[model samples]
Target chain A: MRKILLSIAVFGLMSVSAAAQADPGDFIEPIMPPQSINLGMVDLGKKLYFDPRLSKSGFISCNSCHNLSMGGTDNLPTSIGDKWNQGPINAPTVLNSSLNLAQFWDGRAADLKAQAGGPIANPGEMGFTHTLAIGVLESIPAYVREFKQVFGKDKIDIDQVTLAIAEFEKTLVTPNSRFDEYLLGKKDALSADEMAGYQLFEESGCVACHNGAAIGGNSFQKMGVVEPYKTKSSADGRVAVTGKDADRFNFKVPTLRNVEMTYPYFHDGAANTLPEAVDTMARVQLGKKFTREENTKIVAFLKTLTGDQPNFTLPILPPSSDTTPRPTPFSK
Target chain B: MRKILLSIAVFGLMSVSAAAQADPGDFIEPIMPPQSINLGMVDLGKKLYFDPRLSKSGFISCNSCHNLSMGGTDNLPTSIGDKWNQGPINAPTVLNSSLNLAQFWDGRAADLKAQAGGPIANPGEMGFTHTLAIGVLESIPAYVREFKQVFGKDKIDIDQVTLAIAEFEKTLVTPNSRFDEYLLGKKDALSADEMAGYQLFEESGCVACHNGAAIGGNSFQKMGVVEPYKTKSSADGRVAVTGKDADRFNFKVPTLRNVEMTYPYFHDGAANTLPEAVDTMARVQLGKKFTREENTKIVAFLKTLTGDQPNFTLPILPPSSDTTPRPTPFSK
Candidate 1:
């Protein structure tokens, strides 16, 4: 319990640090990252991600929730899945998942691979146990051979599925956000308002937990620093994972890669709009409310985080079933 | 009705004529048919085709079968599904699907777009319905915005989905096959055995129907033109769609593009190894027996049809759903 208190106190200092930066006008506009991209596995991963028929329901796909058009989410406060059952929390955008060291609000998953394997088995999600999932792939002689080629024979199991996906996600780095450009030394990357917002973000101290490559995700913090968050028992946040008193209200700091589009923020999805989220974060986490100008600037800065959507081809499904209705889309 | 019948007759004639082009010394290869590839549509369609999340089940992704890695197919006699249901037919490679005017052996879909929309709703395959399928994307704000941006506002419908996928499919072409090179004055492109096989293919009268840029997709014919197809109840073939007495034994001529890899051939998926499939097609379709030398040469030439796979990336699922158990190898 004492250690938990210390952890909370450390988190508080981190938030305060963001506001105390020397410039007090620190903004993170992602520019094209300096590194060359490793696209080999990523290319394979993208194809796999969009191709359905991988799920047992033949209908429950990854794009069912983290849709590219809808700010990376399906816009539901909580995601629904195979059974149309509710996911525990809001489905998060995949925009910058790579930047997060420990994933999920409770920091339960260590990386993207760990996260990729979760939903396919969850009762409300893809809903297949690993055994069932492997059986599905194994039964397909095509997959059996392909697995041998890509991951080596017997390597086509769940680990390769997760690893391949994780390797692919690493390529999905949103390198050149306008904010990133500015952060990487581009003076004209941001407009005046966005620059001002960046300043305010630093001055207001949001940079504390929401910094690093993803602008957040580096740490965890209590939802309500100024006021004890009163949002009704709220999904239990981190307590469900840790089962400790001080861990309550702590959630993973999400990447701000595409924050402008991934709205309805917070673990409970309480904020439906970006400005509202910023305002709430300012008031609750910062222990200080910002004027409209500051909030406006920060929101403007956030807009630059959205990245380019790559063009991809959808693979046509194979025809092999014995009988299918005209409307039955699964058969060839 | 008359036009349809006339066209069908002409198509049949085309198939027969191709079979009669059997010159003992000529190399039989797919002639590069000329047509303008809509570069724009190809760009869009390629993106859609690679996207697997369009289906209800994320796991039964298109690449799971018609993959570039394993000769454009998963090499299975049948495919697996969301609930681990083993599909009845082998997955076809998408390597050159653009050539086929009619899709699937049953010819259920008229175009690639129609084919694109078919699999997502197949109960035994993708198992997603139109409503749920659309809802899946509509829920994703990012996809919604993209549909609006790429196709147009509020155009996140199935039409757009199919069109985009079709556009992508058109680009999945085989370029500069050795046969193509040989035809274009590069005589050295063919090895002595390949030349022998090519000569036999032409002499075997394989080119009359299988001629054109995407050889063989231009027409449909009875499966057992010379030797009766024994599997009358096989995988519904093309009779399921047209339901005509004359169409009972008929099916679309598949593109021989990369046919070496898209194995376990025939509508009923009776063949296992490529050698077996090729040899059987000779006996059943051509009414001729191939000597060991001839068959080996033919198989060798067929391997040249394989194309290189394209590069892509995978998306990272958000970590909020971290129930991901440590993945074991995906065992067959």
Candidate 2:
């Protein structure tokens, strides 16, 4: 009877341990292959991503603002746009952006495809109409051929272009971060300081909003929950999308992956360094002040979030034909 | 005695044919490897080439003007620069530019490295001083580390930066064109019309200036050798370098390789299409007005020069640090 009781107690402990081990909701998941990844569409999207011909100036491509090179952001406080116009808000990093609950700082778009269409037609951005962009692609024999292969259509459309671009973007996820390695049973993957930062991050309430496969991208949060954040930019954040006064200053939390490379943080890009950004976030969002040593540890941990960047051969764009419209860079 | 004489005759005939076949100097040679190419330096150079952080606006890079995807030219009549300023002269294709007798249309800069420096400081171009650019590089840890490794020095300099970039450009040659294949004894490499065009190109004295490894970059010829070409821009061509009135219209003969892709031809970027360019070149330089058929054939032959482009991964640039100067896209 004592031996049987011991067995039952052992089984109960095993069940509890297993449940604790399997609970992955609090940690950001490592990037993996999505269910629907069309290679043909991705390939086509890559060409479009790099092709500057889509702009009215025949210069700016999707890669111009959302540069795949520098953690998918231009690293500028704000982007330089058509006619060298200054963008009102910081350009968000496009790396792992498909994982976001919605697109843009204000969550203006529902998905990556919807977000792709916004920049092409923005007079301050690419400065080209969707009609003209489609016409430009239609004129190119290579683009037309690839579009037909990918979309099963005789004519290239804006929807097809956006869809292809979004498909490519969905593949741009940085996986195998040191934190992820630690989560995946590698205890020594992170240093003592980084582990401490991770602990502090969870205990300090960062995980409350930042928990998901892409940490911080899965939800919307007010920028200054405690102390009001100051910025010169006039962007109204989620108020633009939600059309409610209560949604003011609420923005989609950006992914922390590769945050080290995506500098000049926040929607306004007011924080110039990681240390400053961490300090501000601690004070404003969590209503807690971190010690200097604690801030340094968190910043160091943030750097470890950087993962392997997207690696691919530069696409050799097909030469423009006689019929193709020439890019007018000097003209409005 | 009869057999001996027959053998002697056959030997003489073979020697004559061999001499004709071996006279490759008069024609452009196929691109071959240079004596030295440091992989590390090339890697650094590529990152620098694609990095817009070099610009004051953080929007322009070497690739912004000399795009590798589009035949190493921006496909612009004149390049757009800082503040959306228009460049006076056409941006030359950087592909096979090392083969040129000197860099730039006027041969103002003696080499590629020297040419690289001008654009960075040019108010109309990148609009950033070398000091500022070097300062920016020093602030970035990744750039600093790479520069130290490549240059064997603790301090980064503009010379090292240009050297690394030039080393990369040395590899940007487009080889293995149909014309090159034909030169290598591929009998049917080109179509009959293209063959006719090649024959006409050789016969019309076009090959006189457009010869050697780059098929044009070897010499500076008067833009209007026979008849004065009109242009609105006040660029004095080689006179800017030579300081002599006699050298007024002399400009570097751009490579015929990938001419099909590098459109809007001439120092002025006057001709928008290949057929128009061929006609203009024949009229202004050779003083020979060709029939419509002749012009078409010449254009067709030019298309045969498109070769294997530089195939490599798009470089991912390092992010800027806090100490790095923020790009003043609106200010300067």
Candidate 3:
């Protein structure tokens, strides 16, 4: 009976700890430092991020597909661009994009600068040639002047354009989440089911591949861990960028910061719910199956990733300056 | 000699005042409050905004289109959904959306709450049915408990969903644009060309149609004041929502806060550049023709409306809890 009492006491203590996990449905992150990463010259990038005049058609903006409101990603499985043509792969969220060592599903671009240059020239994305982009921007005296001041140039150029956009992207880091709070000894930060999910996540060896600052974006992993990914995907995954057969079906592990919001889940965007997706991960990737209850607990834990709403300042373009001599295109 | 000295003195005097009209781009406003919009509940709205798990097909999040990193608006003229299906209208920016009394192009929904509900249920937007939505959350026990605590229910419900999101939306305000600073007595906030544009904006009566906290969104105006909008729109302006002839060519005036970034400007996305759009506005609404010089100055002035960037805390989601119940239907 004394031993039974001790067991009950221990169970009660476990229950107390379990009661504290929040669903993260409230978007509460704790213990985050301000202005953590500053890759200088990013403010210039902020302007480029919002300047749609970079497009040849002058209609499309970079924010068209990858957005911040829904977890740095658009809701579509395949992104739609300038002419409403379908993009090859799912649009990844721009949030925390700076954290990646390489970018895009195939990891074609090395950094944000290289990544910024890709879409503007892509046949389907911005559908604009560099010369055409310069022509449109040069038509407006305001752009011509800002371009020279920003890039030390005589005309609107692509290097400055992409660099400015990349600088802005580097600043797009997500703040503290409920999980962070829980880790900081706010023991009540996670609840019983979320705690169970965490235990499951660890025991299931998800941490083997998904651990670290970005949770998953640190490296690439094969889609089907034990088996091959059984789903149909449009883009050939990592092989498109690296051109290696071994890299086929291997894609960069995306960050789970706002994973709950950045759904259609996976490269092809086939998963529907966190629970269902979690269940699939267990079955296919780990080769360890999750029970219905286990899946529910894991889903409960995944929902805690929502961070606080950010305050975004809408950028306003100024009228052209007269004192500042607007540069004209020189004879080539 | 006295007259020349007097002119110089007048110019010098203008330098000291905050609302300098020394140049078209130099006009400023008085000090206003910071972005004091309470984001407490709106934090929840932001989570809802980004979480694609809410969709039936699980493809899109509100941020998928209305991105903050690239201005509040998305780059696409019309967004594509789940199966590469097309969206009817251009995605409007969430920036200053709270200031708009009515929501959407047609003013179909009067408040953000009503507006939030429509998109979730829209087959093309989120494609979520209420029953299945609840099921998605219920499957996660931690979310189930959140539904119970926040809404006092045991199931995922629509009322709770929209309210939490609406609460989040209220916090999404654009504050302290350079214009706001100029308005608030920051004498040097704007450049000379921008001052000239501000003067033209006031003198041209553009203020009559585009004024208030959002600079426009408070009301609706006919697409063609000077000429009927010179474009074809599959999303028939506002006629589809009201079924009235008067509303045919009428659409909600979008906030010009970040107009430069939300390119392919206008309801059907007819104009490409801010200058081009401004020229169209001048000719059609005011029936006034602008010289290239004037358009340049006005565009510069518009750039002064950009405000400061807010600090955001990105949260990491932890595990879930067992006692937490799924949100119920209409619990709000």
lDDT per model, in order?
A: 0.61, 0.83, 0.63
Provide the TM-score of chain B versus the true chain B for each model in turn.
0.80, 0.92, 0.82
How much is the lDDT of residue A99 in candidate 2?
90
2 versus 3: better TM-score goes to: 2
DockQ (C-alpha based) per candidate is: 0.06, 0.63, 0.07
**DockQ of candidate 3 (2 decimals):** 0.07
**Candidate 2 positional error at A282, Å:** 1.1
Per-residue CA lDDT of model 1 for B25-106, tens digit only, reads 1323444432676554554455445444454544344544555444556555566554545677667667677767778766
Best by lDDT: 2
lDDT of 2 by residue, A258-304 (tens): 99989889998888899899899888876789999998888888887
Evaluated on chain B only, candidate 3 has a TM-score of 0.82
- Please provide TM-scores, in order, for all candidate models, with all chains considered together: 0.65, 0.92, 0.59
Off by over 4 Å in 3: A1-38, A41-332, B1-38, B54-59, B75-93, B124-156, B175-200, B211-231, B234-266, B273-283, B286-332
Residue A132 error, candidate 2, Å: 1.1
Per-residue alpha-carbon lDDT of model 3 for A191-214, expressed as tens digits? 999988877765565655554556
Docking verdict class for candidate 3: incorrect
Candidate 2 stretches greater than 4 Å from native: A1-25, B1-25
Candidates 1 and 2 compared by DockQ, better number: 2
* CAPRI accuracy category, model 1: incorrect
